[model samples]
Target: MNQNLPCTEPRPIPAAKKVTRRRSPISLIWIVPLVAVLIGIGLAVSAILQRGPEIELQFASGDGLDVHKTKLKYKEVAIGTVTAIALSEDHHSVKVSVQMDKRAAPLLAGDSRFWVVRPRVAAGGVSGLNTLLSGAYIALDPGKSRNVKRAFVGLESPPLVIGDMPGRQFVLGADDLGSLDVGAPVYYRHIPVGRVVGYVMRPDGKGVDVRIFVDEPYDHFVTTATRFWHASGIDLSVGADGMKLEMQSLLSVVAGGVAFGGGDASNGEAPVASRFTLFSDQTTALRQPDSIVQKYVLVFNESVRGLTVGAPVDFRGISAGEVSRIDIDFNRRASDVAMAVEISLYPERFARQQRNRPTALPTQQGLRQILDGMVAKGFRGQLRTGNLLTGQRYVALDFFPKAKAAPIGWNRPIPELPTQPGSLDSLQEKLVAVVDTLQGTLQRVDRLIAHVDQEVVPEVAPTLRDARQTLARANAVLSSDAPVQMELRDTLREVERAAASVRDLADTLEQQPQSVLTGKKASK
Candidate 1:
């Protein structure tokens, strides 16, 4: 075992040396985190620097809106997002903050409008139905104004004419709204061509002012001479002329609509903000204007049961005027009640047919003279049954040559026209008179019958009884099964036999005259 002690003396341990490790400025382990932090900082700066502007929207409600989810869109393009929602200072509305993209900043202006789009059914039609499934969203209608805006009041309803819809607005003066509503259709020749935008009660509260917009090409049809009327429902009229039914369209019947048309004369294009009158119906709207109207009152001592406002005042079956007002007044002086009927005569309507018309438009002296002459000739106004079914009556003017003469009163504000009982009234009077005469005659006949029953009937009673007995006996003799009838039948048979015998004798004489003289001639 060569385990002999080798050089057991360990060499001197190497002296300790200073080893200074070169220190790198940055450690490789930290490099990754540093780069990461730097990238994060850069992204944050970009988000702050490139951010868009923010605006506030005031809405009556916060319905169907979600923070960070609701979006504002224009032409179906998303442009902004709802960031915050809070109640307004007055607690009357919900104020929403929207962060709009820088690209959409240019579209924000004072006149820009915003509204929540949802399923809505209006008179015009159903709209915003697509929003039912996709959820309600804010809709933006960019304005033409250039003024910048930071806050805006949201619209409760979507605009009827959104964006730059090519149209022109017109004003209509109406006695009342009459079923008209915003977004109602405007019709031309039964076709929808526009929409009602607004309606306002007049400042004086006397009527309504309706605003409507007509599309570009259809606007051309609206001229100075065009007539506007309510075409809201079916017009069914029955009168002396008979039944008349007029309809515009099925849509117009349900939604309420305005219709326009022109006469042969359509002068020029109506101005941008032109104003027109809204008549009750197409017939009234298109009728020629009555420039010369003369009003007159008629006093009648008889009943005016079937008379009504708008009843036609006919001149020999031709329409000349209409009843305007019917009133009743007490007369303390005469102590008699009478009906006061005010009628308007369109003198110009008849004047158009005259061979010579008045030279000027103002004065009506010539008309007065003509009416005076007519009155002198026994011409007067009378109430007559125009329609038997409806019991409608109308004023009729005709010449009554046999009637008593009456004078016209031309001094009052509304001239007084002489009136006479209607033909029906006269007929009723005649019938009543005839009935009275018949009643008197019947009374006299009744008295005669009573006298006969008391005196003459008693005296003739026995004679009448005897005559009845004789008639009874004659009836008994005439009976089929009586003895007299049987005896008569026997006599008739005997007569027949005798006649036969005479014929036989005559025949024998013709054959042999000698045999007739002979006693008898025996047959074989």
Candidate 2:
């Protein structure tokens, strides 16, 4: 019975375990992190694609620039960043590598320009002042060309903005550089309209050649007759017009500048790269009003100590020319030294017209004929004092009727003007003659004084002695008393009675002339 019960229980327990399968919510932990990882991968891919090109810049110096810190700017806007700085292979310059922004990609061209922006004081003015506090940066000027590039040569100094601006270029010639400098402003009627870009000594080394740029609208004022002058620094002149202070502007006084004007706008603008002379000052620019110039030579016999190059050559108080050269030449054949002066005359300077007219000037032969006529009429050249205090002299042409008649000497290339002694020379000669005459007169006076003392004085003493002796003899005779005196008195009385009788007879004859002749007229 126990065995049977155990078998039955075992069989029933095994079939009852058919339990139900339960369904649970999925865990959200891994979903958030998976989505975030996918987003990160997409952002990284976009960043790699958007990166701009890298470029290399060569510069003389790495001053004020820092790798990974310095920025590239265009129009004061950041456009790129400097990523690396290294020395060039030659070690003569710095090699800077930059990574530009995507927007600035088109700016990389063959003609692009780069320069460091630092505080600078130039002839133009004070610039890049903001860099003083904000720190220095690199500046970029986009090229106008279409060609692309990756390497560029950097400028040591900032280039003029006129490179892309509308303007014109011109060349000016000057005797000297004066105070002019690169970046010096160019003015029109005291208004700044351009600037000087470069300067160099001419091939002949006689003058300086300056390159200038004039901005739009104002460049039209420059014509063939336009005049340019140095307006740099201050021009202080104490003259007949009193103290004259001239300057283009206050800035010009400190930084130097140039001025241009004096052309009629109606005459049309001068072509590009036109050449003009740069006068030293406004006065000099205005001095050469005429276009036609004639050259002549003059030989002076007197000392030319006070004469200098650029001395005025005047005709009757009117400025006619300028002394171009003053030299002393010793003639070996003649064995004498002569002072030769070369001058350039502008006849149009004396013309009544304000503007020069196109006309044929007198030829060399015609000039010779005119000079001959003038010489025959006593026209001569002489040196005259221009400034007595400075002892400066000038050439003067005038008519002197008493001057010796001379003919024009055409032995040299240029016709020689007849010369006579200057007024100062004549005065010196007169003084010398006066001194000689005075010397002769003094000698004669000395002789006259000697004759009076030696000859006249001795004769006067003898005459005085004779006069005194005669007076003494007369006195002795009057005072004498003797017998001869008594006898003389008696004789004198007898003579008196006889004289009375003769007088009575003369009276009777005078009363009766007929009685004296015929003794019959006694009745009277």
Candidate 3:
């Protein structure tokens, strides 16, 4: 058989030459995008799961806050963002929905604070505006506290113009405007710390009770002995050299602030809570003791002059504390008015550094000895007015401590309060004395007039008749001679001189009565 001849065993027609082809470029394009889409979906799921927890906050007003756009921050770091905001079912407040990061979850404790901050125009300067452009965020503070549930009130309520509250809370009520517009300041010192939160009517509708929130640190300054009063507005003060009213802020023209003064302090007590308290942390200030002689109260037989609340309680011209309370004591047998006051001392000035060694503490007898020494001197409590225009009062303790002259029994009948120089009571007494003297002098004048009418007038009448007869004869003679006319002119001139002298004397007496009668120097 020739090689070229085909074998009967079928030459498998070279199985249609199996062809090898490359995948199309277009297919690869679709595959690449599909893989990218899957990765993106996975990333989105992760993001959703990472968001931590959410809570609701109620606010009376949303002044500077916004939903979704606002962010939550902790320690000035953004911790979460607000998701939504809606009105409550009752339409009384705004309910804000917030989502926080998981990392911030543990920090959300029961004592955690939450308050919306906007542009704050305060006595010092404008603040919180950066939060606006930077996006409103929630600020987190991991305060040192034990509780773990987080809840807060959103305050749109302004601060208190006067008075104080014990804890943090929401705005409950407000007062209807009385005759005065309630915009005066609430100050801690000269520094403005808070505002008029609002006002409300008492259940019985007797008077208005104003609510105020002093921000933390400043809030802690208030204690049982703390006093409050209205600063009113700037007053024009005039003196021999100049006149001015120390008005600084135009915004404060209508607005007012509250102030701090006294407290019944404890030793080494720290601030109760640091974050989100209605008032500032006042514990530090309260624990301190005063260096100067501290006065507890000053009473007067009458109203003390220049005594006002928020007035500086001075010891040797240095302010240690302020007057806290004022009330009257009315007893039928009492001769004078009773005033009650409380004072606070500076802590740092009086506190002593503790030694490492343990030693027996002073006994009650030793403490009494110290106190007795303080009381034995003139160092006693008194009252004085801060500003005459405002009539605000303050308490001042005299440095000279005297022995316990009067037992300070709680239930004992309070005696009359001591009066200041030229007090209201003294002035009233002087006025009464002046009136009595004037009455006596008037009675004497009346008697003199009666005598003139009864005796002098009757005698003069007879003399006048005799003169008339003589004058008649003279008239006949005068008709012939001119000498009578000259004599008449001279008589008229003498009468005029006498009248002038009497008028001069009356003017001198009226202008300088003290000089004429009492020989005392008179005020110009």
Candidate 4:
């Protein structure tokens, strides 16, 4: 009965076709779109969380750095990206914020350093041009320290204030542009170590406060006894060596560099302060006149024809140093003009190289002896023209080692150099003396000529005319015949014999003047 009823009830529907059911439109419109949107948002959130924390760094310069466009690199691989850029409160520096990849977090330490890589011009060479085009990056030089919460500074340019570990301190000063101004180099066996710090006028204006720098091992290497001198540029000179000086860079004209070294503490007992100042500018404005003491000396039988205040005080023509100051002394004791020259010599320039050799030789006495011997041994002083147009003069010392040597003492009289006329004054005096003597001699000669023409010539002319007339009359009388000719021949022979005898007598008188004089005196 139930089957019959179902059949009947469905009979009306079975006469048509089977119906297909459709899903809800609301689910297709809202739920599927929601699921896709959720997936995208979840992916974005996960990516952001995985990227990790960002760091902020401050910098004094950003010359080679870029924000967002530049990356932070470690081990030559990019590890972070610059996220933002802003100015610091002081406005003197730039603050850069960097977002590091999560994978790189462990690599960073508290002591990690960040410096800007930029183009640098140095005496050794120039560097960092490739980085300029790529934009400057944060260069991470991780340190050995183990602190977890770390901070770092991003540099825009190289640091003006250099750092050195625990050792000596080389305080360097700089100009506004940060260029160094010094005459010499900080060298280690001719190798460069540091640069000249700019100089300042001392408070009292008596001197300059110079600054220099030394890094680590080199700082320790340059001990208290270290010596500094100008090795910046070529100081060419034409002398025994023909040319002397250093010529390295075109930039040396406006700027200079330094070098250092020799040996460790090889220098004999260092001074208490261990600091020394070197100067190359010899202008009076840069010097303290009273800082140096000069003594009055009487140079008896000695003359400095070519010596000057800046002359090289040489020992055997090898320059030990220069004559710093000079003065003239009126010798009340000896009634002569004396010269006193103060000289400062440096053994360090050469001594540093030979530090390991032996005891430092006594420079004062040894150099004195060498100088004394040189002067006595025909070592002559002469003036040399340094610059023709400027008329700047320098001193030259030449020696003949074979000449006689002289003795020297503490206040010993400087031996006279071989004299040679060089100065304008000396030359003019000689010319005047020569001209005066020549004029006097010419006047005397003219007077003698006039006397001969007016007195001697006239008197001798009348006598000579009379003798010629007498000879002509005698010749006319003797023109007669054979007897005259024979007589003339005999007379000629006698005349010849008399002339020979006169010549012999004159020769005897000339040969034995003393005998002739004695005979003449006796006759008188």
Best by lDDT: 1
Off by over 4 Å in 4: 1-53, 58-67, 87-94, 101-126, 140-156, 159-228, 237-243, 248-255, 264-306, 309-324, 330-338, 342-440, 449-524
lDDT of each: 0.89, 0.85, 0.56, 0.58
Q: Which residue pairs of candidate 2 clash?
A: none
Per-residue lDDT of candidate 4, residues 1-524 (tens digit): 56566453344454667799987767656888899999999998987877856877888866555667888887669889888888889898888888888887875677666777667775434666777677666777665667754457754444333322333435322222222354334555555555554467667666555666554456667654444444455545533223445543454435655443333566553332255545342121132223222222213233544455665544444554565666675779879875554445455433444648546644666756765665666665444444444444444446646545544335545423343334554676899999999999999999999999999998899899999999998887787665778898999999999999999889878867887556633433
Model 1 Cα shift for residue 58 (angstroms):
1.8
List, residue by residue over 303-339, the lDDT tens digit for candidate 2.
Answer: 9987888888888878888899988867899999989
Rank candidates, TM-score, best first. Answer: 1, 2, 4, 3
Evaluated at residue 277, the lDDT of candidate 4 is 44
Candidate 3 residue lDDT tens string, 169-252? 223122333222333445656677665545667698754566555665566665544544444345354321134564424544
Give the 10-residue window scoring lowest on summed lDDT in candidate 1: 358-367
Per-candidate TM equals 0.79, 0.70, 0.37, 0.48
Candidate 1 per-residue lDDT over residues 1-524, each given as its tens digit: 47875756768999999999999998899999999999999998886676679999999999999999999999899989999999999999999999898788989987999999988888878888998888889999988898999899999988998768898999999999987899889999988999899999999999999999999889988989999999877878877555678878887778788999984334888988899999998878988888778899998888999888998899976789899999985698999899999999997777665678856543578678888898889889999998888878899998888878788888878899999888888999999999999999999999999999999999999999999999999999999999999999999999999999999889888888897568557778
Off by over 4 Å in 2: 1-42, 162-166, 200-208, 234-254, 271-273, 289-293, 327-337, 350-368, 411-413, 434-524
Task: Give the better candidate number (3 or 4) by lDDT.
Answer: 4
Worst 10 residues of 4 by lDDT: 281-290
Model 3 Cα RMSD, 1 decimal: 20.6
Give the distance in Å from residue 392's predicted Cα in candidate 3 to where it truly belongs. 19
Who is ahead in lDDT, 1 or 3?
1
